[model samples]
Target chain A: MTPIVKPLIKTEALTKTYGSIIAVDNLDLEITEGEIFGFLGPNGAGKTTTCRILTTLTKPSSGHAFVSGFNVVEEPVKAKSGIGVVPQYLNVDGELSAYENLKLHGMLHGMEWGKMKMHIEKMLEFVQLSDRASSLVKTFSEGMKKRLMVARALLHEPKVLFLDEPTVGLDPQTRRNIWGIIRRINQERATIFLTTHYIEEAEVLCHRVGIIDYGRLIALDIPEQLLKRTGRFVVEMLDDDRSKARFFKNREDAGRFVASLDRDAIIRKSNLEDVFIKLTGRKVID
Target chain B: MVGTYAIFWREMVILRRRLIRVMASYAISPLLFLIAFGWGMGRSLQVEGMDYLTFMIPGLIALSSMSQTFSIAMDINISRFYWMTFEEFQTAPISSSSIVLGEVLSGMVRGMLASFIIFILAAAFGIRLNVNWALLLSVIFNTFMFASAAVITSMIVKSHADQASFNGFFIVPMSFLCGTFFPLSRFPEWAYLIAQVFPLTHASSCIRAAALGMDIPLISFLVMIIYSILFFLGAITCVKKASL
Candidate 1:
């Protein structure tokens, strides 16, 4: 019999509050090893707050959180050593070169010079920034800076990586490049916890997706299962400046729904975004 | 320890890149003050037994060190707001204590460098005074006090404008009223009592006395040390609060 493996990351009744407002309501989560878990939330939905708690940057107000078997509040240093965080914003040093930035990160992790040198070179190559390693980060394009942030986060060979909106502002081509990099990194069996508002990114990359709204998890499942739970097809009706989606069990049913509408309507396969809209009565990005 | 060095190293690298700008900013104002006040108005005036330039040298050192130490808060604010580099340390394995220690040490180093620059400018104007261990100790304590104060202020302020306003309200007044320009003996009794409340007042008095080959007052050194400890504690508390 195959043994049941424990999750690499777990949270039980975890909550964070600011004065009178709750930023993250009682959240319970379990992310297994080597799984890419996507956290989908709109702006002000507390995804970043959850990441911060798990990464040990902020403490949870109640309950418990564990990263790589170490409690975040009780054993923060141990948990931090096992996890790498790529924040939503660009946090790399603008005055320092990419190489120097990564070096500082490595040093903070207590890596020796000899190992850090080789690791930095390998990471720069992995991110395809080998040639621009010596350039100041302020001079790099947005894409290059994002790639460099990835390199710095991966420098210490962390077992778990938390990427918060890693490709929030990038051209389509650059976004695809980052997607490829993320895929390659996930292939090495690292547990990835990613938060993004981009529907396509969640559908394409996550093995499992969690939909959060108003500081609560609304849905959790594999992308295909989530879409299937809503329906197999979607019928979208376009009005003057508004759109509405209706899910059907099959293509014929969707076509029938479209035919019944006296306005412009498009029938297509249901996606993760459709499931999110069906659950929340609002667009994920909006 | 490794984490502290990492933070310090980053500051040193940035300082190296902007070395010229830093030196100019530290040197220009003090040079102007020395020329206008020391060379112009006090060329013939004697304070105690020495020329005005000689008396002003130690005061200038104390003032420059205080200003330079406080300037570290601007750098901290820039990193916290614009660069977001402080978040890097926040998510790392470093402790909050390490972060405070690293920043305070870097500020002290910058403050000492500014004092050296002022010393060089003094020499350029052909003003020399006695330099000894007492003067060095006094400057170190002064830098520690202000650097720690800067850290506390940086964590409390919200924006760059807030930081600038803090300097405008607190640092500028301390620079002028802390016996850096004129003797505290010239002030009325109430004003003298107010001046004595500032850490810089003791720092300037201790440094000036040592530079003139007089015995350093035990009270001034003791008060500066107490202020350093208080500010250091305040800085650590604020840093931990900000991390949350």
Candidate 2:
């Protein structure tokens, strides 16, 4: 007989509303330990609100959330001790050195001085920020600041790390660099709860992906499975004043359809964007 | 407790970086006031049975304590609106009360540092009065009350323009009309009643009595204590609401 294993994160019929508009409606989810779960959504799609709720930054209007076996609303401090969140905005204090910022965070976390110092050093090295440890954060570039944010979030070694659009605004090379950091952290057995609108990021980093639209969870599956379900190939061509996308199960079939068309056409493998459009019967994200 | 210390330590680190500018802020204003008043008209005037300089020093201390402590609101606003660094406190495992207490403690330190500079200026002008435990108590209560008020205002404000409006309407009026330069006896009855409603008025009276070695007004102390506790609670509530 096998014992039941509790998921690291769970939400039960979670709902949130602001006046007449609902932000999140009856979300139910379970993320097992040691898995990278990606929440993908466009702007105003409720991804941020869900992340905020799980990180204990916002309370759900009704329903339950648990992180690391502690109820978020009932035991926020206990739940927060197990969670680390890198918010969408850059919040590192420009007045302090990178080391000082991490030191402040550790102190607020109530970490012992010696242990906190050691972890701060390790995190700086991990983020490749050890060389600029004493430099004020305002002097750092955007990529460097983003790295420092990651180091600060990981300082306490939280059991679950929530990265909200970790690579939202960065060069392609820098975005890849962050992906390596995310992958390495997951290899260390920390559960990663990532929220991003970048479809490629979810495909590359997530073990399972949940796509939300208009404050609802529309799809949850492995990226490959989702793409498979939506068809594997796409042929997009000019149709009147707008471009129309058609999905096919096989590249050969897609090629045959493209040949039959009399207009300029492009054939490509289906991605999360196509899946989102297919599931919602709407155009891909803006 | 650790949360409070961490918050205090963060402010101290930032303060230390701008030590020269901060020291000048503490020294320059009180020096100008002392030179203008004590070396000018205060050289010959007398008020309330004491030398004008003596009468003025305690009021200056009270003013310095209130202004410097309440300057914490500026720091909190910069953190909130520009840096967004206040969210670090919100996201951390610390309680809202701890955050308020921590910020208030740092503000008190700033206020007391400014008061110490005022004492030095007073001494340089040959206007030393005995510094006693009651004086310490008065300054503490004053700083605590204003610091709590600073947190509440910082949390409630939505923008930098709103902060300027708050200072203009609330702090600026109190600074000028709250008996910081003259006695409430100088005002007409209704005017005095309006002035008396401000906590700064009681703070000025309490600090003046404690510093001048006069018969202290126990009622002033009671008024300050009530304002301090109420403002502290309000600060905590404001912080919690801001996070939400």
Candidate 3:
């Protein structure tokens, strides 16, 4: 018999309410070590709220959360020590250089001076900001600022990292660069919990994606399996300003479906966005 | 403690980078006040036993410390709204107490720097008085009181304009009427009662007494201490509340 490994991050019936509105409702989740879990949701879908609760930035209205086996609410300092958070907005210290920003984060985590110096160098190199280490953050491009934020979050080598919309508003090349960094970090066996509304981002980077809607977890599975829930292939018919889609069990069926349509239609593999639309009756970016 | 120092260290780095700007800010107003009030008006008039410049030096120190400490509110607002750096501290393992302490200490440092600028300006005007430990302690207390107040106001105000309005409504009036320009005895009886309510009044009284080589009144020291404690508590409460 094999023993079951406990999850590195777990939440039991976690909920948060702002007066009459429930931001997160009866949420239950478990993410094991080394797993890259992506939280997919639309605007106001409580993705950031869950991250806030798990990261110990805000208290849950009820229930509990644990990060690296430490209860977030009860042992917030310890939980915070184990988890690193990169918020959605660019929160870098603009007055300080890239190296100084990372160094400040390390010092806040109580890293020894010798270790901090080495870690700052390593992080600057990891994010490809080594050349800009001495430059103030205000002078950096938006992409560079995002990379610096990632470096700051990872400076302490945390066991779990929470990235909230890490690559939002970046150019395509920069977004892909950030994706490569996230994949490289996950390859080192650090659990990553990311929340993003970018459907392609979740499809390409996340091992398992959780779809949330109206403050509820609507679906949870691997991207392939979730896509399978809708169908194996998609037939999209483009109109003047709108598009309609149909799902089928196989490529042949999808091709037939496209042929039967009078308008121009295209057949392709189903993706996480299809799953999200099927589950929530709305587009991910709507 | 490491976290607290980290916060303070970041402030120091920025201060170092903007050293010229900070020095100018500290020096310009006090220079103007000395020129207009002490050099221009005080050369002819005598209110107390000493020259007007001597009497106004302590008041200027108290007023400068108050304004410098209250300027922390603008820094906090900028960090919270524009840069969002306060969220970095919020998500770290640092305690609320450490954040408050670090910010208040930075405010105190600025307050003392502004006082020292005024001191140099006073000397340039040929007005020198006996600066003692009591005078230093009074300035420290005054700074702590206003710094804590700044933190509270920063948390409560929704916008930078709101913070400016707070200065316009509260700090501006206090600067002029808190015995910073003249003695409270010059005010009418009802006005004197109101002036006594401002913490800067006690600070000005204690600083002037100490600078003149006179005995510092125990009650003024006690009042300043009590106000510092209350404002410090209020600041901590606001920090915790804002984090939520």
B1-244: candidate 1 lDDT, tens digit per residue: 8888998998899889899999899998899899898878866888766678887888999999999988989989988988888888877887877888889888988889999998788888887767899989999999999999999999999999999999999899999999898898989999999999999999999999997789998998999999999999999889877774
Model 2 CA lDDT for position A261: 89
lDDT of 2 at A197: 90
Q: Worst 10-residue stretch by lDDT in candidate 3 chain B?
A: B42-51
Provide DockQ values for all models, in the order shown: 0.68, 0.71, 0.69
lDDT of 1 by residue, A1-286 (tens): 9999999999999999999988899999999999999999898888999998998878788989999899988887778888888998888888899999999999999999999999999999999999998999999988899999999999999999999999998999999998998899899888899999999999899999999988899899999889889998988887777787788889998887777878888888988878888998888888
DockQ order of candidates, top first: 2, 3, 1
lDDT of 1 at A192: 98
Fnat across every predicted model, in order: 0.81, 0.75, 0.75
Scoring only chain A, what TM-score does candidate 2 earn?
A: 0.96
C-alpha positional error of residue A45 in candidate 3 after TM-score superposition, expressed in Å: 1.5
Candidate 1 local lDDT, residue B216: 93
The models' CA-based lDDT, in order, is 0.90, 0.90, 0.90
Candidate 3, B9-87: lDDT as tens digits: 9989999899889989899988988889876895667767777888888999999999998999999998998888888
Looking at model 3, residue A273 earns an lDDT score of 85
